[model samples]
Target: MKSLKNHISLIIALFTVLASVQIYVAVDRTIAAYETRLKDDYSVIVVSNKAFVPSEFKSMSSMIERSEPISTAQVLDRLKGEMSQKNLDLLRLTLPKFYRIYLNRYPSPKEINNLQRLLQRNPAIERVEGFAQTHDTIYKLMLLFKNVVQVFSIAIAAVTSLLILKEMRLWQFQHAERMSIMALFGAPVWLRSAVLFRLAIVDAIIATIILCLAFYVIDYYGFLITQLKAVGISVQLFNFVNDSLRSLGIALGISVALTFMIVIFPNEED
Candidate 1:
């Protein structure tokens, strides 16, 4: 029952919802890819520097740090001192901060027995959990938060898109007669084709841009974006889409061409 012009907000809102869904998927995928690459590089770097760092550095560091919270300055100082006992590999590889210097030798039961005898006496050494113990639970929790936001964003976007689409269709029905009459008239093939192609293409381009910008605002501007850390996510997607703009151009061309063909060709008594 609504006029199309009267429902401009609904159309725009639909675009916003679609864009938000796209932005969440794109950004999460990008971040995951980035993290994977970084993890690989970090692992390689850590591995290469292992010889210079103490074999039991993680174990030993845990022992010492049990007495106090790890001060970055103190940790780095300790690392520097350990790096002084250089071998060939240690000399070549650079040690990075927070780069896990694995205790290459897993503690045998006999070694553990000895370590317990020597170290467990101190109240500061209350517990000696392996690095895996600390990293796993915390890492999973971080990952869970990251995924929850993305999922929540998608759900909200989907619901908004459906609502807006419903509102937009109410507006669109008002134009149905005009569209049917255009088909009824003997509109020239070239004119109809060009008009339809232009209309669809222009609308698609406008939609894409609006979608992209809405996504950015949803991510970056806190007021509009209720999702957590969504700005960072949106910005990342913008960068990705911007980088692959050629794809958009190609898509536009294909869409316009297809629309032109559909409009120009005779079908169903038009």
Candidate 2:
């Protein structure tokens, strides 16, 4: 019963580490999807004295994905009631051309400033509006979110790693007498450590399986998807096949590495 309890504790520790890693992956991907959606909805407005084709804006900066000219008809409609035909025609001639420029992706504040400068450098452009205040707020919020997740993941990984090491150390102490007897019989180091390695490998596998199933059920049920959709962001919660394999590799690798370290470092009495 004690052995079973130890095994369960070790498995839970490994699962915690793996789950933290997978959550980081999911959050990273979701943020990327959110950025894509933001890029589609966000745009800059440029007022130019001369009309420009969409292709012309592309050359201004690689960040500029596309450009759309705002029709003059809407401006003319607003002035129609306030002016005669001759005055309206003159007003139209005086008004600068307006365009909405889209970016390929959401950019950092520095990139936004750079793009604004690049647009303003054009002699034909009278004004460029990049919505700096709103963009900065959103950008800062996204960065804060990502950093918080990263710090949280690192903290969890660090604590869980120590727990894992402690668990393996206990396992080593439990088997110390048998290991010592094997050493006295001139058994090879690998032969002496075989049991420890087997135990680590099996527990790692079990932990990986549990973690994979938990993610699969979460993904299959659309629990995360529903929440993301509520906020206008759509992203897959996890990739079942690839993430499962990755989690397995990480769990087994950490387990075997820790076990090997314990095997190599003998106790002071030994």
For TM-score, the strongest prediction is 2
- Per-residue lDDT tens digits of candidate 1, residues 37-102? 323322111222123334333454342211222224564455665656564246334432333322
Candidate 1 lDDT score at position 44: 11
The candidate 2 region of ten consecutive residues with least summed lDDT is 131-140
Q: Rate the local accuracy (lDDT) of all candidates.
A: 0.46, 0.89
lDDT tens digits, residue span 1-270, model 2: 999999999999999999999988988888888888888889999999998999899988999999998888977998789899999988888989999999999888788889888999999999998885775686578778888988998999889988988898898889988988998999999998899999999999999999999998999998889998998888987898899999999999999998988888755654
Clashing residue pairs in candidate 2 are none
RMSD of each candidate?
Answer: 12.7, 1.5
What C-alpha lDDT does candidate 1 achieve relative to the native structure?
Answer: 0.46
Question: For candidate 2, what is the TM-score?
Answer: 0.95
